[model samples]
Target: MSIQDTVDEMAPLRPENRHGTDPLMVLNGIRQEFPSSRGRTVHALDGVTLTVERGETLGIVGESGCGKSTLARAALLLRRPTSGEVFFDGKDALSMRGGALRSHRKRAQMVFQDPNDSLDPRYRVQRSVAEPLRAAGVSRADAAERAMAALAQVGVPEDAAWRHPHEFSGGQRQRIAIARAIATEPELVVLDEPTSALDVSIQAQILNLLLELQERQQLTYMFISHNLAVIRHLSHRVAVMYLGRIVEVGPAADVLANPLHPYTTALISAVPEPEATKRERIVLTGDLPSPASRPTGCAFASRCWLATEQCRTEAPPLTTTAMSEPGSGHLVACHRPAEAQEALASGLQLTA
Candidate 1:
């Protein structure tokens, strides 16, 4: 069957694939390795397994070098993973090439971290927005009509569409970028820090715009960022990464309010809270281990204060705990779940 046929056969809005329906996208055992100097291989993404359900935002949060960006690229098939599976809309994405890949690309789009990186200085905003459609064989006149509509949806006026990207502010550039992403009416949009480059107030506007767009189109999103607060705002589900592995994942409210993984707790602790919502800070002492020479067991074991000898010797598999959150079950890969929870229960005074 054709890729479009496969898409047509499936029903949408099924969460966690409970009803035997396929989600928008699924990544299994995705690994991206880069050859470093001195014959060392840097494991950018090490066995990442994730899913983005239809019409829901799955936020990926991690520190720099935790393979968040690499994950995004791998998932989008922009850069194929060193080894793994990428299934989009129930079709084998990694297997697609030529026309199949091209057809599938229409259903999935990406909005990058910096609009400057995506927009061309030479092209006007209208051409930039219409480029994807033109590539898909849409006539110039039709592409322009769709592009104008998309720009209007993102609050970019018809007048601004004729101007160059340099003529717009940073925030406006991002809106144009978003317009280009949705012009094809993609089912999934991988937003890789789409608002990180903008000012704080502008950040809120961009986020609100994204939410509005998603609602209007029933779009799925794989939103990646290091900012937990922003993730909390835009995500329906959250995945926390440490050293190229998912340490924890669940509904946004449950995972943030009651994190089961030590790494997630440390991340949440770092977020400044008001006096009434003050949390016990758990200071992680050691620097993040180099991905080129990762630890033998749990990636975060060295810096995890609650880690035991077992955590050092054996890597923990991501498993569903008794502490699963509502709507979505929580998955955590920590050997010492009880101790990790205890550390937060008691006023965590000691440093890792």
Candidate 2:
């Protein structure tokens, strides 16, 4: 049977579904904290609120250790947030217990950066692919049949299904990992830099597969990556994170093409696009603020050339800038949104 035959149709949209809410997932006031050596708490995620509409890819971009993976796990309730709420399909996921939580988890899956971490070295590719479906209570025989179909969907040959992960190439291993994720028929797949470890040519193949699978399965994705070019290619919307806070977010075209925040510009300017030589002007200096001492005002203030007294003394709420399109929801947390683009062109130089 084709992979299509193994998977059932999706359920009808839930009624009262946040009642007119288009968001399939809603995260509000999400905060995650971990204790450090000196009994100081590291705020990995601080007050992040965002929505992922059904069947859209929301690309999350940021530097390493900016809580991209933490946010991905938190959204799935893998690590309960220190303070906040997560709603999946209008149902509060935080309070779920036993079967309900398992059901929620089944609908949301994650694709990690390394297939070596996600796939067991000892398990046969077929067995690994069938594991989640079996856990979801599928009969062993049926799970085996579906697993083969899933593997085929991702271009794994039927005869190779019995081989261990060690037998596959890096790209093939990732394809199997993707097969395992989609095998359960999840609604949302949180991909944490899934292609970062692959060769550039392999990256394109994996990206193309993800796009095809999303179109076929109507999957919602929270794709986390440091590659802005990849984000621009796969995302309908983009959220730029810094020091555990979203500095800017909006429609992908608007945020990438006309970013209002200095931090967002810095990320875009480093994309290594063909035009990067001429356009790569916004070089941000300084590492992200130390975890033990986060900034009281704007997280980017220490490095921002535009940092004014207001920016240094007070945190700017992420609100719509003057240039933001109405109903488009483009927002930035900058005290001087209007001057960012022009300033960059007119000798606003920042040291790397």
Candidate 3:
């Protein structure tokens, strides 16, 4: 099926239907904490809740330390969360052990940021691609056959399969990594900054390859990246994170075009525009708060241009606003969402 076909098939599942229908993945109130050297706990993730429907792409965007990667790892159960529930295809993923966990691992896969780091230089490309199949108990001969087929599918030459990862360029190695990811025919793929390391031209090629693979396999993607443009290009929905919390989430177009949270607005504004168009930029001040010493109220209040007394004292819950369409699920956590929305609508330049 084509991407559009998969989208159309799953179109009936609106954000409102997320809880009602069976989703590919569900993370409810996930929180990850680590003990800092200073004897305090760092909140890597704070109350992150999200759902990924089958055959849809959910793009996660945030600054470097905003817990996007932590959320991804928690979803995949790589790093168990300090608290929360993880449901994969309606099953309790966190509670599974041994055989059940192994079975679940086959259904979900991850493609890391750097292909060079992910692929073993000591092994042949084919061996690396077939590792998952071999781990699943497939015979060596069958795994080799599947590996070559997968390599060919990703535009890697069949003859090059026996070569080491160092033999190929960065983009080619990424193709090999992608081939390995889909070789198992996983239903969900968590891509953690998969294309960020490549040049712009190669990034486009990899993105196209990913979209094509998703279409052919009907795969669901949890794509994590700092690039808003890329997230807008490939995501059906977008989640914006700040300081271990999701500040805003909604349909990709709606969230990017009409951001409702101060953080989201600032993030979107930072996206490079055409040279001819003059757009107001929201330049935020103050460094990101240390996770171990996070503010008691809104994590972003210290740097938010629209912050009020309420923002400084009271934590805002992720609330669905009237600005959101009934099924669009546009939610924002802010004490002054209206002011933020108004600032964007009025094209006011904000420096805080």
Candidate 4:
């Protein structure tokens, strides 16, 4: 069957399918832009809308400068989008002020990409970890006690709590950072490339630690990374971004195993595969278009081998697609999704 025929056979994803119980975070029509000195606006994020279900990890993956970090910041309310509604646990977070906003911010925490950059070298580990607690009005003694326990939970030695961030190695520092992030017992955590700065072995350790913490604390995560393997391992759902928009989103395993979007297929094809089961790679052409001067049509049309005249003239909406697994939600934005799906099914090599 043709891809469009296949898509037609599937039911559209319902709103309930995209959410569970009460989602921990929701971004509705988020659009972030910055005015350049040249008087043109740089579109950092364009109409990003997604939800992070409580206790599930939603991974955002894309090339650098694809607005992954911008989305993260906007979700955390660190950088309020130029236009959008942010909701936390059904509350309109974008409308909160003063103490209400501070309280909401405490419920969500962030673990940055670099521990060295995130940690204060001069502060002792306990103080660093206790900062959030202190900010939340916890007494110094209680905060210290919680800090020690948090440090211990992440496998940092209790004795090390008295030492500065400079005393620990990169991995240990990240552990400290993780300890600090969770010290306040946040319901949601936004991890921005948390493992990218570490070595391979250390990356595994950190990932495992995060998994452990999630199980123990029922933490919801917005895990952002460019590493497909990492996303596959850690995410319940994955969102694929390009330029300033999410092009594909679905259950992580489904999207990784049967990518329906050309951009997604090209990305997955680049991952290292076992020689015995390797398929031809999809090599894309052309540099990424500047966000300051986005194309009138699909942002990825310039590099898509399957792109047609329609792709060059009109942007595709994020449309729902049939998933192999029942009750799974898969959405892709492409003018030629059917062609891209056929190419993958036929194991046809795509190059541009």
Best by TM-score: 3
How displaced is residue 335 in candidate 2, in Å?
A: 1.2
Cα RMSD for candidates in order: 7.4, 7.6, 4.4, 4.3
How do the residues 1-352 of candidate 2 rate in per-residue lDDT, one tens digit apiece? 2212211221112222212248889999899999888789999999999998888888899999888899998998878999999999999999999988877777998889999888999899999999989888889999999999989888889987899999888999999999999898899999999999999999999999999999888899999999998998898788999988898988776677777898887776666666434543677787889755788899889988788899998999988878785667888988888777665445436554
- Residue 37, candidate 3: Cα error in Å is 1.5
Question: RMSD (Cα, Å) of candidate 2?
Answer: 7.6
Q: Give the TM-scores of the predictions, in the order they appear.
A: 0.92, 0.91, 0.93, 0.92
Output the better candidate (1/2) by lDDT: 1
lDDT of 3 by residue, 253-335 (tens): 66777778989888877777656377668888877898888998899999998888888889999978877656677789987
Q: Please provide, for model 4 over 86-130, each residue's C-alpha lDDT reduced to its tens digit, 9 standing for 90 to 100.
A: 999999999999989888878999999999999988899999999
lDDT of 1 at 318: 96
Better of 2 and 3 by TM-score: 3
Candidates ranked, most accurate by lDDT first? 3, 4, 1, 2
What is the Cα-based lDDT of residue 233 in candidate 2? Answer: 83
Write down the lDDT that model 3 would get. 0.86
Candidate 4 or 1, higher lDDT: 4
Q: Which residue pairs overlap in candidate 3's backbone? A: none
Once fitted onto the true fold, the runs of candidate 1 whose alpha carbons sit more than 4 angstroms away are 1-22, 274-280, 325-327
